[model samples]
Target: MSIPSFLKLVEIQTKVASVIPFLLGTAYTLYRFNSFDLKNFILMFISLIAFDMAVTATNNFYDYKNAKKTYGYNYEIHNVIVRSNLKEKTVLGVIFTLVLVAVICGFILFLNTNVFVLILGGISFVVGLTYSAGPIPISRTPLGETFSGIFMGFVIVFISVYIHIYDENIVKLIYNNGILDISIDIIEIIYIFLISLPAVNGIANIMLANNICDIEDDIENRRYTLPIHIGKENALKLFKVLYYAIYIDLIILVIIKILPIYSLFVLLTIMPVINNIQEFNKKQTKKDTFVLAVKNFVIINIVHVISLGIGAFS
Candidate 1:
C-alpha cells in the first residue's frame, strides 16, 4: 500500500474529528487540574490514531466487499481498495496490526492508571469494531451520529482527561469479600460533558453532513441512516441546528464559569460556521460541498482548542 492510498483508506483527512477533542481534554486538564501526563498522552495518541485508522480501514474494507457499483463504487472514487486496488490481504493485515498496537498501548495505559481505563478502552474498542463489522453495523442505522458523537467526541475527551486525573479519584472502585462498590464524581463528569459538546456536535455534524449528502445513495445502498429515516430536508435542518448547539454549549460553559471567559472567543467562529452550513444547505452534493463539513469541524474545534489553550495560560 502506497502512502497516499494508506492515507485515503484511513480517511486521514478526518482524524481532526478526534484530534481536536483530545487536545481540548489536555487543555482542560492543564487549566483545571494543573496536570499533564506526557507519557500517557503520547501512548494514548499513538493508540488512538492506530485504532482510528483500523476502524476506517475495516469500514472501507467492508464497503469494498459489499458496496454496489454506484457513483464510482468500483471505478473512480469508490472504496480506496477499488480506487487503489490495494490487496485484500494487505488491508486485513494492516487492520490487525494497528489494532494490536492500539491494544498494547491501551494495556500499558491501564497498567499506568487503573482497570477503569481498561473498561473505558474496552467499550471504545467494541464500538469501533461494531461500527463497520458484524451484522447490523452501527453505521447502517440511524444511531450512527449518537455513537460517533458520544464515543469519538465525548468519550475520547473523557478518557483523555481521566488519564491525567485517575489518581485524583474521579472513579472509586472497591472490592471486598467478592462484592464491589463504585463512586463517581458526578459534577466533574457533567463538567467534562459540557466541555465536550463542542466536539461532540462538531463530529456529529460531520457524519450528519455525510449522511445528508449521501441520503439517496444511502437508500439505494440500504444504509438507512438518520438522513434516510428523517428525510434529507429534516436531516439538513438538524445539521444546521447542531452547529448552533456547539456555540451554545461554549457560551453555557462561560456562563457557568466552567470554561474561562477567554474561551468565548471561539464563539466568533459562528458566522463562518453558519456560512458553511448555508452553503451545505444550498447544495448537499458530496463532491461539491462535502468539504464544508470537514471545514466546519476543523474551524470550530481549532478555535475552541486555541481558546481553551489561551485560557490555560490565562
Candidate 2:
C-alpha cells in the first residue's frame, strides 16, 4: 500500500489521543520530579506510537472483515483496504511490522528501566492487541470507555511519569528468597491518578462521542458499543459530564497545590469545551458534530500540557 493508504489504514489522525496524554505525563514528571530521561522518553515515544498505530490498523481490519452494513458510504470509500484493494496479507504484514517495532523498543526500554515498565507495557500491549481482534473485542462491548480511558489515558500517563523515576521507589517489586514483595507509595500514586483524570475523561469522551454518533450503524453491524447499551440520551449526558469533570479535576489539583497556579489557566478552555459539548448535544452526526468531542479534548489537554510545561520551567 502507498503512504497515504498506510496512514489511513492505521487511522493516523486519531493518534492525537495517545500523544496528548504522553505529553501530559512527561510534563508532570518534569514538574514534580524535576528530572528528565531523554533516552527513556524517546524509546517510550517510539514504542507508544508504533503500538497505537498497530492497534488502529487492527481495529480497521477487523471492522472491515465483520461489518454487516456500509451505512450510507461504500466500503470502497470508507475503508482503506477496500478503497485501495490492498491484499489482507499486506495489511496484516504492516500490522505485524508495527507491533514488532513496538515490542523491540519496549524491550530496550525495559532493559534500561526495570520490571515495572515491562509489566505495565506488557498489559498495554495485550489490551491493545485484543481491543479489536479477539472473539469479544473491547470496542464492541459496553466497557470500551472504561478500558480505553484507564489504559490509554491514565496508564500511559502513569507509565510516562514512572519511566522517569523508575528507581525512585514509587512502586517496586523485590524478590527475596523466592518471595516477591510489592510496595507502593500510595500518596504519590493518588497524586498521579488525580492528575491523570483529565486525560482519562478526554479519551473516554472521544470513544463515547464516536459511539454516540455510530449507534445506528454499530447496531446494524452488530458492534453493540457503549452508546447502544446505555441509550443515546444517557451517553450524551456522560459525554458532557466527562468534559465538566476535567475542569473540576484541574481545579482540585490547583487547590491542592499539586498543580501550579499557572495550570489554572486551563480554565480558559471551559467556554470552548462547553460550546462544543452543546453543539454535540444538539446533533450527533459523524460528519458534523462528532468533531466537537475531539476539539474539546485538544482544547483542554493542549492548554493543560502547556501550563504544566511552563510550571516545569518556572
Clashes of each: 0, 0
- Specify the poorest-scoring 10-residue window by lDDT in model 1: 67-76
lDDT at position 99, candidate 2: 97
Q: The CA-based lDDT of model 1 is what?
A: 0.88
In model 2, the runs with Cα more than 4 Å from the true position are none
TM, every model: 0.97, 0.98
The C-alpha stretches of model 1 lying farther than 4 A from their native spots are: 70-75
Tell me the RMSD of model 1 versus the true structure.
1.2
Top TM-score prediction, candidate number: 2
Tens-place lDDT digits, model 2, residues 1-314: 89999999998888999999999999999999998899999999999999999999999899889988854652557688888888999999999999999999999999999998999999999999888989999999999999999998899999999999999999999999999999999999999988888889999999999889888888888888888987999999999888888888999999999999999999998888888888899998778888888888888889999999999999
Number of clashing pairs, model 1?
0
Compared with the true structure, model 1 gives a TM-score of: 0.97
Q: Which number leads on lDDT? A: 2
lDDT, candidate 1, 157-275, per-residue tens: 99999999999988878889999999999999999999998889888888888888777777777788998888888898898888888888888889989998988888788889889
Error of model 2, residue 221, in angstroms: 1.1
